[model samples]
Target: MSPSHRYEIEGCEVIWAIKDDSIGNTFFDRGAAEFFLPHLTAGKCEENKPLKRLKYTVTESSSDSPKKGDTAMGGALGPDWKDGWRMKGKHDQAAHRVQVEYQCEVQEVLTREEFTRTGQTAECFPGTSRAEEQNDDWPVYVLLTNKRLYGCDFVVSATGVVPSTGPFLHNDQFSVAPDGGLRVDDHMHTSVPDVYAAGDVCTASWEPAPQWFQMRLWSQARQMGSYAAKCMVADRDGEDIDMDFCFELFAHVTKFFNYKIVLLGRYNAQGLGKDYELLLRCTKGLEYVKVVLQAGRMQGAVLIGDTDLEETFENLIVNGMDLSPYGEDLLDPNIDIEDYFD
Candidate 1:
């Protein structure tokens, strides 16, 4: 998940420790593994050949699980891709190319670990039972369910994040959200005056816009930090400032599994109930575009692959333009939607 492995840090050695052998799990926003695996393989080279060129396997429990990126993943990519010319497309292509070109084996591992006696030594490993010591660098391990045994360099647990609330919550000075996050007002101010919280640590306390909700994403963290700073300055001058417009609607753009992912507003049809309608156009191995509409206006959208429709869809969601007349043709690949909207 980090590119720092490419450089040598003086007086520092970084080891990525995780409980699981494979990367990315339910704890991660979907498609995170796809976005990150390439970098990980790219960092490891053998005989001047990048590891990405080697055959590898990506194992998952469920067949449908690999397709999690088909829907909105509830996370945002870094904003650096926002304005760069063709940067978004190129990044998407790279991710997809890695996915298609790489030799990935996907299968389910039913039992992660089980205990059984082997006619071996009593050396202990984290997950498995005692086994006989072998003349290997690391301890020998067995999978009872799969009837397999292997040796490895080390175990790294890549489990997801858990909120650290010991310092703030245990003190009883601040209010906590149901999800164990510190609750903050629209100004990003906590229970105490002149004390504010931003980023993943704080839960949004203000009344959210109809189309907007909070996600512990990097983009939102940056937005909250900036908004909190503005709020602090305004308080010093006794001036008032409205909440930043970024919170009015949700817009996220990122790449996953080599596909361009753009999500806007309630991309997953969140809170829309049964009244909303969905229009979809999908080309196998090419693109998947889905639009959410309430009445006649765009409420949200998910555009995957190089559709190049983010700007138009974003405007449509914001302007509340009625597309009922165009109906299904709104997503027609043959149409020049940009010019039509312009």
Candidate 2:
């Protein structure tokens, strides 16, 4: 069930089948504010403001960092980003508490029944485990895993979307990707000419642009849907249509750990390996900025906080302009980087 419907659904009892009762680590994409914020709020209005002001601590240092330093401690602030710093600080404090309380582990999920009847039952009183509470008369079913057994009545599958193509793939009419998504061409058309697939249900079949690849994100889904419509119309009219420009570069704006995060192109140096160089500027608790450069040209960037550098970086990446002359001065705090671009 989505976090939005957690409180709205009535009559049917909602049970969370989770490994632990800790509030953090409920979301898979730590950078997704939509997912992360809801879990933190948990259908509470009062928690919303505080959640926005929470400062996210950078626990692990990035491989590209010069020295192991806390990215959330002190950092240069962009204009109107004092709030960003405050929020990150608060989030860091809260995150520290959660870290101390909950040590997360990755484990395979099992059905509630499969877990309960595993022949390893440990009887314990209520409130001992963070799992659901049953009637005093009814014994709580404790499901055991390699890490720990969680006590709960019903298990909620909040894990994520799993591609299930077994039923459709059984038919000989379609070709499916190894990942189980329907293989689709640049036009978003599937193997069957008349049939087309888009969004999470389809795998990109065309040679992707250097800066763009498929991700199962809402933004990509929207782009695919719109582009697929145009492709379908062009096919109906027997007109050729070029692929949409949105696929030329990857762009995503989100909030992670209470800071505005903008990921552009190969933000993590995706397929570039060690062939690229990274220039980073971090203000502890203020902001973190990372730019990926390849062959002296800007290829990608990760902008945290309200850095107001997205347009400049995006242009630099799309245009493939050489910034080697500027060197590290491209990220120099004293320079008006945007003005330089102008």
Candidate 3:
């Protein structure tokens, strides 16, 4: 019988199954790896390579199942684990929590079918609290789950600014198009004019010959969101807004667990950057990284394994910086290479 889900002990930021690649390692000691992400990312960033696609080869390892009587700590990984992360000197506990949860959920799903299908049963008693008969000295403990006491004078719905439905939690977004070229929007806005949306929820239209421009992405989102917010505020205040700025959305790139992943602009934008050549290089591991360029300008990057270069890569992409400065240094692993700025 096949189980609905399976669990494992591993830590990974990006799990690309199509490429048979799983960037980042999960199901490992959290404490040990907490110190590895930065150094690893930095090492890869120093390489400055890029990839349009890639694959991963996963190796499975066994983990002991919890004992019959072991108590579930809900979400906390116990005091020792929590303290270990805190002692590491990183302020971000949410990252550690997310990685741990992913592993635990994977494991729990694997074991669920067995426990539920074996005709097992859970028993609980119905309790009656008699108001008058209760002892007067006992203290009552009340746990609030759905209390809505936190009131906000102004409500900002950051749910999303794009037309697409939701977050890119498990997989990327997919949608079909009219021409039927298999439009892979990735996350571009669906419309324009009176409204503009960016980030992972829009499909932008930009044409070199047509001489028009529109794009979607995190950086674009920040700019567009600011513009939109200002527009709204301006309209409310009866002020004329510029609204002349154009959005040049680029792909989002980052490193995690050691995997380098880049999501270039709408995948369906065919012939968009087709003529622009990009260079890529990598060594095999649990994580991989890639860098992209166009006409000598560093356009974007996808990094895993090492991400220390994220800031530099992002700067170059945003500023459309000339990549010729560090072309030679990118491939050299031992060149004390921060001089690209000079």
Candidate 4:
């Protein structure tokens, strides 16, 4: 979670002030320090490679929804997840459903005067105008679902981001992806020669490995930035550049919910639709391992805890060897899978 996307009301005490707050994965949970700066940013950040520094334009969005000045923000920047979890689709979705949801930024903050009074408020709060009741200087929040307004003390928004493709759009100089990022080839070159882009501002236009896809995450940003620099040097020196192995497969390592987690390939079965098979082994709070297989070939695996399967599973995915004969025994806890394969 970038501090850039986190916004808070002055002296806000809503989530903790109440009980049963089931907002979208409440990343900076009730009573937790707003960052709660997201552990994702701590260890997984890109190294300070020897490259020229690029500047970014930081802007805050202040749009408003009419029903309530309140809205939960999410977009290009993506969602703020728990203390960890580097990249992912949305949360609390049904197994049959895969969703990527982006909530609009809080359109506007409501002042006591700008707030609307509705009978629902009277029935809900019983005779007290919520707007009139909140601190005069603080912004008011409303939970709006389907145009119906519910009174709320405050809301925590995990803002999304769209690539800022500045003046390049003026003359149509660079190809832009639907997500509003500059499209770059394997070398991270824009359609316009000699121009390169990296980080959240550019999109990978090449055909990615089947087990790999892109998400706007710090880890990816680091990889792309470093790779782009190398490509620049290679081009300047008239040398050939090969696509970095980092782009060959999707992988992330982090600790979330107190478990050491290692993600490999299409760990969530993303883009596989319903054509994949899933096998999961979990031991309450201690461990969770999920593997995605297609036609008996390993495509991805999510290994939580120190399950010691990362190396073997990674080899399994990259080598693309057949594991059909092992059947369920592939994950049999009683059997030593590594030795079986060795």
lDDT of each: 0.60, 0.64, 0.35, 0.61
Estimate the overall C-alpha local distance difference test score of candidate 4: 0.61
Better of 1 and 2 by TM-score: 2
Cα error, candidate 2, residue 184 (Å): 1.0
For each candidate, give its TM-score against the true structure. Answer: 0.60, 0.63, 0.36, 0.64
Task: Report the C-alpha displacement of residue 66, candidate 4, in angstroms.
Answer: 42
Cα lDDT tens digits for candidate 4, 141-171: 4533323333444555545557888867888
Q: Provide the lDDT at 264 for model 1.
A: 88
Better of 1 and 2 by lDDT: 2
Candidate number of the best lDDT? 2
Q: Output the lDDT of residue 108, model 3.
A: 20
Residue 99 miss distance in model 3 (angstroms): 22
lDDT of 3 by residue, 110-207 (tens): 13334345443321111213352222221211111221111111211212133443443233333423322113222222332233344334443333
**Candidate 2's residue-wise lDDT over 204-228, tens digit each?**
9899988888877666777898899
Model 3 ranges with Cα > 4 A deviation: 1-227, 240-274, 324-327
lDDT of 1 by residue, 101-158 (tens): 1222212222223222334332233333445322244432422222333343333332
Could you tell me the TM-score of candidate 3?
0.36
